[model samples]
Target: MALKFVRGQGDGQAESGEGQKADNTHSPDNKSKWLVNYKDRLYRLSYYTGVQLMRFGKRIRRHAVAAVLDAQDWLLEQSAETRERAAYARISLRRTLEQEFFSPVRAFRARVKELRAEYDSAKSQGGDQMESFLAATSQELWAETRKVLGITFNYVAPLGAAALLFVTITTVNSFSFGLKVEYNSKVVGYVRSEADFEVAQAEMKKRIIYEDYIQPEDAVPRFTMAIVNDKDIISTNDLTDRLIESSGNELQEAYGLYIDNQFMGATTDGDSLLENLNARLEEYSTGAKDEKVSFVKDVQVREGLYPLTSIVDLRNIESELDKDESEERIYTVQKGDAPTLIAQKYDMRYSDLKELNPEIETELFVGQEVLISRSVPFLGVQVTKTVTETEDIPYEIEQVTDNSYNEGFTKVSVKGQTGEKEVTSQITYVDGVETERIVLDSRVVKEPVTQKVIVGGNKPLSYIPTSGGTNNGGFIWPVGGNGGYVSCRIWGYSGHTGVDIASQPGTPIYAAAAGQVVTAQYWGGAYGHYVKISHGNGLYTLYAHNSKLYVNPGDYVEQGQLIAAMGRTGRATGNHCHFEIINNGRYLDPLQYVG
Candidate 1:
């Protein structure tokens, strides 16, 4: 079938032909101009289809806008619910765009163009009747248009599906993955990002085995380090080099770096770590080079022994006698006096009295006199003496004559019993017998009278018992008052010991009890002007920081005796007595024992 050119084809141009208008819509060779017609139809269909598609697109856009508005409304509602729900809603929108809109937009646009091309081709091809062809093309175009609409609808369906899916999944995940942070073995802290995770892994590899290098006995070394974030390693050598540069000392030889108990590194150039440590130790040493403590050896002393002399050395004595000897006096003893009593009354040494009265007899009779002089002239005096002797003798003799002839005639013959006695005399020499003796005559008058005697003794004396026993008890308060306010407790800072009590300045401080003053002085250190009194028991009472002390050392003070006046002397901050009671060398709570 020959298709005649009609009015220069639909594109409006001419092709080669005799008395025939040229068809310029396409090339001269008839290559099925359906593309041209299709293009035309596409243009027309696209115009109308675009009109319809634009209407549908507008409808779709409107629907999308409405869905977005709905989604936004839902999001706003979700936001109103709670902070956690609002976050979920935002994540839901991001997921929906990623999965549905971004993935399906390309396919939907391509399908619309395909449907328009098919409709244009059918329109360009002539049909049996114009109406029938128009109807068929219209039907075909409607079908394709419906297909495009279906594809668009299909593409858009997922957006809603994704929105729903994301909302559901995000709701669940919010419960599951809700901002959890945990420290893993690799990480030094909570890892929240990929960079943080990577840093943690790297740090794990650079693990410091601190226990390996650090010996248990090694002194814990100190270091100044520039700590790297998240890493525990220390740059000991670099630090030591810097220190050496700053201090102008050889630190590499003296110091080292340690981390987690491990000796990571040491400095090599300067003084060793040992030297630095030694210097520090010497600073705190009990003995130092400049201040040395040494023992002083005992020295033996030799003494020259000399012989004793009985002769008087009167060289210096002559001068002393000329100066004041004339004023010296000596007195003799009275009758009823002994040397001890005499020496005591005169307040002279007994030995000195004995030396002065060597010639005077210790046994003095009533009229006896002795020399009493200050000079050697008194020693030339002499004493007179007298002696006496006495003797006694006794004798007896007996004789009888016969008177038997007259004895019978008269019983008047008396029994003459004569006891013979003898008397003798002897002459003896005597030297100055000034003492006299009296002799009385001795004679017997009567013979004897005899009487009978009884020998038995009487009864034993009756025993009696007396009744009485004694018991005594007493107590006394050491301090004057019941108790006082606790100013300070048994606490110490630095080397200070004991507590302090606050009392008025110039208050008469009494001895806590009967005690000997161990220490009474103006102590200027921590305890101030302090006094320590030692009671016989282990207890000791300290009265510190006083204004005045009434008694000297070794003075025995009784309980409640005024020993000192309180004052803010020495280290005290105020005018108050600092009283402390120490027992067994340990400070006790004075409040417990004072009252």
Candidate 2:
């Protein structure tokens, strides 16, 4: 590579020559052709530059194609080498496995074949020797066996007899001997062993509650070995019976009262005991002709042997039976449990809770026990009775419509009275709680009265009921014309709020009912001259577009009295009376009242 420096500004002599050339170019003739020359030169430069760029692109494409071909050839060579190396590796691995693992396996297989051949040969020769040896050994063994048999036969009968005698004696002893149970110096019975008597004693103790008998600690029996037959041996229950018999009149025969199959107590006189119990049951029965009473639990008397002290008196048994079934339940206080909360958890009243747990305090600690009161009767008496009672029959309501009053208005016309009826029913009660009721007979003594009520607002008809049929409603027609006719009703036209009564100008309009005048003025907007009358009971009447007003505000006007003169005074095409009925600031159809 060589380096060259081109002078940016030409030397002094060259600069003078370039300046002379520039001046020459700036002349008028040269200046006129300069742009044309510069454009031609620019075109030539662009054509040459494009040609050079094409050549450079052609060179780059050739090099890129050659590089790609070279890379492809290199990859092919590498893949072929990889295949060769993989084949070599595979062959080497096969050789390694054959030498290291399969060689030993094949050697062992050949050795096993040799050993098999040697064993087969040896077995063939040994089979003949074994047969001869077995023949000689069997004969010698038989000879010795016969000698031993002859010796054993000498004592066989004696030894067998001794064994049989020993077994027989051992079995007989097990069967013949038993424990003789003796209690209070008297023999009770014979049991297989003391264990049998112990079981019997345990059972006897269960019946010793309240009995005047020797305690188990004091009644410990003595056991002695004695010869007895198998039939003489007693069972545990039989031993218990013998022991009871040996009590020597300390026990007696009595009737045990069992309620619902559970033994309650024993009584000496069952007949008298039953009579008293029946009386107790009857005491709860209703003294009616068709009344029936019975015990809820099954009661029976079974005859059995019982200790004389175990016999309960009739009065005492009755008192025991009268006690409640359930024991008093106590609940343990838990965390976050208060006295009130504990009461609520058991569904008890606060007062009842306090009564049940008199020692309970307002604050409860965890693990503290609080008593809860709940009762369950041991015996319940179920009573069925047929009874009759007088009952009331409700009256029927009937509604009648009257358009003379406002909608939703109601008034009772007839007062109703409830009638009396006698009803007979079969009622069953258990422990004072009603369980069932069935109606037997019912008869009405008097029929119920039908109540009649007058309701407002219904389909319009020709007649409207009034206190007295003088006019349609409580008010008389305000305008006179035989009966005033309504031309345009309220809501008959758009924006029409009242009824228009067609009449001649200056025709007299009267007050519809007795009322005080609220307004009387020449209000010449929509109503030129009008009179408003306030009738009691939220009712008001407006006479609008009137020619003249006769009543002044605060002045009282009677029914049919002149209040205004009908005329086309304001917003009217012809002479007429615009009448409106208002109730509590609400516009009502005037025709509904007048017509």
Candidate 3:
């Protein structure tokens, strides 16, 4: 390549063209678009008011094309007379003019010639030249324009390409259509815009409350806010409702407590109803001592089936929550359970349970239902019924005078016996409580046997009854140990005049009853140590064969006082006590008085 310079007014030209560079940026196809657009305009205008202007432009373009070609031929003629670089510059300029301007104009003229032939051919065959008073439809006009312009491609391809190009360019700049609200990593709802997401997020925040590190019984529900994340679209209204419902426990599982089979109130725990019921009724049973009955809501509180307490249900619940009365619950009669116990369990009076269940008949069986309520139905009712029970009967005693009997000596001919009598009464109950009892009938169920006694009516004044002293003439054991055996009662092989009691050698003998010591002696011809006491009216108690005598001759002795110790002495062969009970010097069996 060679460079050429042009003289400038600011300084003398010297190698100026060396720094200059030619611009060759355009392609032929890109240049052809301008001619193509201009031709399309002319083709359309030739049928309308610009038809003459379009024809004049074509004639002027022909003359301009001829002038440009002759100028190129003159440049060739001048090139032979110019310097080598100048000659080259002129040739490059001519070629650039041909491609940039002359070629497009020549192609346009040739296209017009071809379209004229085609239009003339179609007119000879009576095709539409569109010269009628009625104008062609837009579809027919576009078809004629394409045909005259000799366009080989779709006319709207540029617009379609521009639209597709715009979409492709904008794809990287896209934002989400809406925001998705997530809970535990699951999509719950959507927000349409940044503003909608903000609003929804705020609404979710309001539903949330803090609950952490709290006790189970005291831990109330605390809802968490829903989080918005980038995701697909959803209905804002419908999902918001479900989210709110999840956050609130207004609808909850609970059991309804029914009284007399009627709805009363609802509680989350059935046991709570029972507890409240028992607490309320505790004072009504007279301290309700030993209440063994239990109460529970009869209705089951299971999911999917149990009553879900809603706001409306809560309305009804709170309506009666403060009321003292509970729904009537039926209690079963367990073993050892009474109507009174049931009443106490339900905080009711015993009469209340009785009145509600008349069939109880004063007896309850296993698995029996006792209606528990404030159901003391009647204002008043009276119940009259007969009751039968046994009573003890007395035995009559008779004493017969016998002059032949010794003083203070008597015997029971026949022993007395107590008997029984059956008595029947009528009981009256008002309001299930006992009010009155009246005897209706009586009869002796067993006969009593009278007792007979032979008394010594001819006894002197000095004689005393064998049964003397206090405690009905009873006496303590004369020895240290309780009675095991009396060796002899009377005149056995040893000719014992009184009873002989076997004992340890040194066992002490006590006085039989309260009396004075008539004698206390360790010396006697046949008897060893001996003590005798004379009770009032000539009654005498004697103890013999003792190792020692404790009472003096005139000392007073009480019942159970030690009088003597036992020993084998004098006529006794072994350690034994000779005890004697006599009234007015007449011996009597000691067993009759002491035992």
Candidate of highest lDDT: 2
Q: Top model by TM-score, which number?
A: 2
Instruction: For model 2, name the residue pairs that clash.
Output: none
* Regions of model 1 farther than 4 Å from truth: 1-484, 492-496
What is the per-residue lDDT of model 2 for residues 1-595, given as tens digits with 9 covering 90 to 100?
Answer: 1112111111111223333443343233555346534644564575578679879979999999999999878757787778798789999999986775566456556655665565566568898855665564566556645655554565477898999999996776465555676776778777655446545554344344566555332244565666688788766645655666665547777766767644577788888777766776777765888888877786766555667777888778888888998866879877767566777887878767766665454224578887785466787777888999999997766666587875434566887778999999999887776768899999999999986766555432222323342336655677765545678888886778898988776778988776566578875346778898766556788988787788765565677898888876655555678888787778877766674
Q: What's the residue-level lDDT of 508 in candidate 3?
A: 71
CA lDDT for candidate 1:
0.41
- Per-residue CA lDDT of candidate 3, range 1-595, in tens? 1111111111111111211210111112554445544544553454354557668979999999999999888767875556577878989999987775567557666755775676666667663553431253445545555553544233356777999988985773354333344433345555443233233323222222222111123211112222333444443323433344444333334444434223344455555554554543342333222322222222222111122332134444444644444355687878766555667777876655666776453235678787775333211234455668999896776655578975444556777788899998887654456657789899999998876666554645332334443333465667777653688776674545678899777887888876666577755344657888866566788888788888765465667888888876544555788888877778766655664
Which 10 successive residues of model 1 have the least lDDT summed? 298-307
Q: List, residue by residue over 253-284, the lDDT tens digit for candidate 1.
A: 22222222222232332233334323422433
For each candidate in the order shown, give its overall lDDT on alpha carbons.
0.41, 0.67, 0.54
Q: Which stretches of model 2 miss by more than 4 angstroms?
A: 1-251, 307-309, 326-376, 433-435, 440-446, 458-595
Error of 2 at 483 (Å): 50
Q: What are the TM-scores, per candidate, against the unseen true structure? A: 0.20, 0.31, 0.22
